[model samples]
Target: MADRGSTELTNPLGALTLDQLRRRTSMKWRRFPPDVLPLWVAEMDVPLAEPVVRALTEAVALGDTGYPSGTRYADALAEFAAGRWGWRIDPDHTAIVPDVMLGVVEMLRLVTGAGDAVVVNPPVYPPFYQFIVHSGRRVVEAPLGEDGRLDPATLAPAFRDATTGGRPAAYLLCSPHNPTGTVHTRDELSAVAELAGRYGVRVIADEIHAPLVLPGAEFVPYLTVPGGENGLALLSASKAWNLAGLKAALAVAGPAAAADLARLPEEVSHGPSHLGIIAHSAALTEGGGWLTGLLSGLDANRLLLAELLAERLPAVRYRPPEGTYLAWLDCRRLGLGDDPAATFLEWGRVALNPGPEFGTGGAGHVRLNLATSPENVAEAVHRMVAALD
Candidate 1:
């Protein structure tokens, strides 16, 4: 279902209409009432890539449903990395987990202990705070710069504070960071690797959005940087291919951190579904063309959101994200206190993610999902504008 030319690609976001999407029973569709336009979570509105659907259907038809085995997922990811970003991944250095967040927690456990501090750059994915705290570790914040990029000056102090009293600590980094959609540059990540090295803090990068870097931006795999040889990264095709319902992700370790990753409990590998592995492998290996189309669609949606906000909700400040289908909107000018998402849902009949939950810099903001039709994106803005009246 794609139109391709030498330089043009079909916009996947335009494929489905609002009525078609409403038939979905996923959390993004079901969490709000029928009248509300739900644009809150990370879920995408696109259909599965032909390759992934075919692979899954074949597996089911062949009665291949059993526990996961072999290194197909890792191998496919290695191939995707090499082809997409010119990065190399040693399958021997990877581990499978249920999803990105769980893998982050597991990697944290590998290097840090209970009550130890785990530093994060906020307004980040809210689950980064929850999973860290729930795993018995304390959360530390190093808020991003005013420009929505990582600030080394801010991180240094947080690193020092986290390692106080000789306490072991880990830094949970969201590469191509969430909510804000600021794609961290190679220079920025190299600085982070250098800083983490100086402070003896282990880095666990959540790189789930690595594959979705839109036009005009580059995604640097965390482990590929010079001093990042000691860091661990979590990667998945779930976000780019809309396979969140089929859970699976990879925990890859840098050369220097390989031994540490090997220490993970064998039982941890049991968490991912066999079908999830099959689906993820197929997507990474054969869904490249489909992903290219999705990225094109997302690129268009980001711009459309910018235009809609400029015309209708001029008070809202938004920087089209460099990566991910998520948009972080600064709504403080609308006079909606700390949480504008609540007001939007109640008054606008639209469901967006509450900003306060993202920690630190989240106040007076809201996170909107932009992976839907242009019509929905425009309508969501229209509804939000109506809320203000």
Candidate 2:
């Protein structure tokens, strides 16, 4: 059977023209100068799915803009999880929040007190550092293995240090980890659960990118592990469906952690937009076909990126990300010092996320957004090659 593609199966997730994308006021396009090809942010440069557009349009037609309420988002998410990931979700155990990071912070607050240690893996997400700090908690780094994947050897020490001071602690996990796009496996997650349970460190999972797992790769929900019955997971349709501007996410507690989630202040739910809930719920329910198509497109782009890097920027080392639209490029071979993203931005006029900002082993690297068109991807590469010249 000749496999066609997700775009061919459902809707075509278009890669809009430069002029088409620049007119928008979103952060990805708006943050950069007119001459720069902006590819730093996680925002996709594609149009919304038919279901999402319809949901938002219907909301506006009915003048239904108000504060968010009810479990429709949770219900939709439960339905989606069962169909996609084979995980049974209890809608009653889920609650709505403004976004994933905020939900993580609230979850941290639920499990820990001020000055408690929050162990994290880096070259991970940049915000994992900021949000933990903002929560008045201490940040402990457990750098990933040399392969850019979680290692028990590194984690065990971090867990011990975090709990040694007899301070309360939590493990902030980035499943389908950001920047590197390393999707933690079932066995890996089970090992993590065992370690966390052994050390009595609460696990807080940020699974915002759960739905974007590339082809041939599987995304394992941390809470589904053996010892995760007391863990908390933050999920949303924002990343997969490119609905970040909509502002709504869910906090899902494992069987035993529902009480901890319930302790979250009611005021926390007040921040999510009503339209955001409608759109996210619609994405989970009616946007599957579109997501299928988008994934096919991303799978193509991920491979295309590897080929492009190999052809033009041979000095730059890149691994086709296991998940997410972001590409972490190691530019150490270029002798570009600590921050190659800055050099690329200034010389190539192509803005990428500086690696050092991602902490620990992040230097000598740059994160490239790959959720754009193939042509644009090629153009970005051309610019990078020119920068090196």
Best by lDDT: 1
Candidate 2 local lDDT, 254-336, one digit each (tens): 99999998899999999899999999988888888788888888899889989998988888889898999899999999999
Taking all chains together, each candidate's TM-score versus the true structure is: 0.97, 0.97
Candidate 1 lDDT, tens digit per residue, 171-197? 999988998998999999999999999
- Flag regions of model 1 displaced more than 4 Å: 1-9
lDDT of each: 0.91, 0.90
How does model 1 fare in lDDT?
Answer: 0.91
Q: Model 2 off-target regions past 4 Å? A: 1-13
lDDT of 1 at 113: 94
**Model 2: lDDT of residue 375:** 85
Alpha carbon deviation, residue 67, candidate 1 (Å): 0.4
